[model samples]
Target: MLRLGNPRRRIGIGLMAMTFVLSIFAGRLIQLQGLDSKVYAAKAAEQRVQEERLPARRGSITDVKGHELALTLEAREIFVDPSEIPDDRRDQVATILAKELNATKQTILAKLADRTSRYQQIAAAADPAAAQRIMAHDLKGVGSKHRYRRDYPGGDLAGTLLGFVGTDGTGLAGLESTYDRLLAGRDGKQIIETGRQGQRIPMTHSTLLAPIEGRDVRLTIDRDVQWAAQKVIADQVEATGSRTGSVIVMDVRTGQVVAMANAPELDLGNWMAAAGADRVNRSVTDVFEPGSTNKVITAAAALESGAVRPETPFTVPDQIRCADQVLKDSHPHPVERLTFSGVVATSSNVGTILATQRIGDEKLHSMLQRFGFGTRPGTGLPGEEAGLLPDWKDWSGSQRCTIAYGQGVSVTALQTASVYQTIANGGVRVTPQVVAGTTGENGAFTASPPAKRTRVISERTAREVSAMLEAAVSEGGTGNLASIDGYRVAGKTGTAMRYDTRCQGYCGYTATFVGFAPADKPRLVVLAVLQDPQEGHYGGEIAAPVFKKVMTFALKSGKIPPTGTRPSPVRIRAGE
Candidate 1:
């Protein structure tokens, strides 16, 4: 209403103000499009293009006959876009996901409430059908992609030996860890342009690199025999109320481990839930005094060194004094004259010490070394221990006497079986192996090279010792229970004092029996051991039965027929 200035001047002032505003807008646009174009463009590209990893297919683990032990199967990875899920329906979406995916509602809700994130993984290795059921609802922001899941078809079968994998697709223990490099192949990747909602951009260039698959690992374990051994040993462990138990079955001819079983075995599918102690493969890892099972080594050494013959007579009494220690038989006995074979058959500690004295300490130590004692079995298993065997020069006064009766020396279950394997294979000690070989990308099956073999004793001495072992399992022998029907069994019993690390001294007894079938012609050797058994402490009472059961199964399954030839009776008593 109040008119003040000239009309032309007022109009010019308004025009200048509008021109300045337009100039500023133009300058800003030029700065964005030309001066800082690369920076802006890069920001935009980063927001649109996403790089994702394409996982490689892990290898399969098979037993000797191509039976699948562990393998990988296709699955789905379920994910959600938290940014796209409606705030009002977040709880409802989380509930639905929890129902279909078997996930906790709280966990799903936590992931869904993260509106700041564009993508959140809901579940990995989800069942493909379950994923499909989830996608059927056509729930916005929810999707699934292809993935792979490790499958243990046998569940706990050979779990300790085969090992398990981790969530990040790496082997965590056992053979899976041992062969990780060969089992875990190279992973690939893909870079694709995406939309604001993470949808693939149509007609946009994408880069992809395919993954390389891993090789298949073939093992020397026989599936059927392994199952039998595991069942038998597990039953025995339960019956004996022992702390733990182990069994090893090896082919004397090839030194191939047919079955290595442990009680309270690890469950491959649920390895994360198992106790640490149960996860160990005790057959190769745990060491214990060989007890009477070690007597055969003494007999072999004495015979090999020409210090004694199988029939050489010794006056064995209830006890004998050596190195300030009174070595005695397991039980009190009257003084009696018996052959060396008779002493072994009776498991007489006094008789064994007398025989060891003849060969002296050095020869016995050398023979133990040659028989794979004091050294690792070299079976390619993880956590293998070289059983303790003190040098003869380092042996204490009592150690020399106790060692002759299997008290001072420590050996693993596998090593004990290998010792018998040497005797069964005509004194040729072959290195034991679990892995047969690997199947490469070309699919050609290549066998592992022959196991290293060494001559521990002469064939004649081995035969003589074999005869003595046979007598040890006969009617008057300590391991008579180990004799199988229709198969002449040859084995020895061990009930050595257990050295407990927890108690820091001897705490309990280790019951063990190692032997082979078809005594006249040894084919397969089986060793069974029980640690800290509460039911009975005697090897013949607790361990011999386990040996019989496992050996019977192995013999039948292997299609090994007993030799028709009769076992020639070896004199176990002086008069007889």
Candidate 2:
């Protein structure tokens, strides 16, 4: 104490300085250990572990006959850590991958030579078969991740109807888009250990999460029937020099759309680049004036409302005055007296107009609505259009009369087919079923319950209308070619004039034939429409044979035996 004059002061100052130093050190410790612990730990973990994505398998789509229409196959995606390859072996690895993965050699070499990158995509959606060949060589810096690639077994058969998926395994159109959620399963993940050199550690313990495979989709489409319908429609369109065509084979009893086919189809493999015009599901999406095919609806309305009977006679004329406009038959001839049934059999525009005059527009529109017109068929397909049925209030005098003969109203091909189905099913308008149901991983299927049916007309009226349609396909009738040799056929011929886009006048024509086979004991109802045939414009000539071809296939495919009854003779005289 004597040696240092301010010993107490020196001790007090030293203690205070030590306390300040300790306080600063404590603050730094708290900041690093408590406040930023997670941040540092995350940084360390990110560097130590490698994240790999595990893709899930998409579901399969099969036909009603269990034929595989679409499915997903195990595919391999080649990825690489460029730094792991020896300089001399880079070219060798690239060559092997190029040959197996259908990739350019130069592209694969560039990825292999980049020593700075730890990850690079060499090939995506590679075929498992080819990937196996590559892995057999055991090349360095190369690895594969399993994924699912979409496969269409029925190539271009029902291409437009099945639709396709995107690069990331997402559905883009048709039934794929309609039920994508059910088909795309959940993805999994993997966490792997890595060395300080930024390379995966060999035999290191890692965490993994399992993936869930997607559920399957079962469609009502019959592969055999769909193939036959497509071939028949395609051949007919080419033979008639028509622009395009579609055919729908529906079960009258269940409204199950067995086969829906369209021509001018787009490519299913690369749908994104396909022509927009040809990509439509035309059977359910394209609308057109149904021509005389709609006359059956008018017949039902007349019979149900007691406006006329099948035997009721009307004066037949080549042309009749409908308000200020004159309506004429497709083929010009002298006026022939025909009964109401005869009017339908010949598809007489004047007779149909006269019949509509008795029922009036209000009654006629009600009947059309009841027969599943002016609305979508609820088939769960993408881009479906509810056919245009203008309100009676908006209908002009000409519109009212023209609609009776299947003009002034538009209908999609499905709606047109359903109208015949309604009459064929004893006047019960059963909603068409398309999707059927979805099958889960356990193989248990959850069905889409069918929509309730509504009665459109009385059974007696339906029977009379069916008989009238039968007469139309008889000898000397418009759709005579639609008749099978043994089975009784009932259908109508339609050759509606197409409206010019510029509204100048009618230019092109839409030929159509709608009918059902085994009319005595109905089974299948077929509708065929040919748009703007360059050769002939009559539905009887251009469209009826297509119906016959398709109907013959349907009856044979269904194993339906010949119904001995023949089509009733056509009545030419009105008073009979």
Q: Candidate 1 on 148-223: residue-level lDDT in tens? A: 9999999999999999999878998899999998998888899999987678999999999999988899999999
lDDT values for all models: 0.91, 0.87
In model 2, the number of clashes is 0
Pairs that clash in candidate 1: none
Q: Which stretches of candidate 2 lie above 4 Å from their native place?
A: 1-37, 82-91, 106-117, 196-206, 500-505, 566-570
Q: How much is 252 displaced in model 1, in angstroms?
A: 0.6
lDDT value for model 1: 0.91
State the TM-score for model 1: 0.96
Clashing pairs in 2: none
lDDT of 2 by residue, 128-175 (tens): 888889888987767887878898877777888888888888988888
Model 1: residues with Cα > 4 Å off, grouped in runs: 1-27
**Model 1: lowest-lDDT 10 consecutive positions:** 564-573
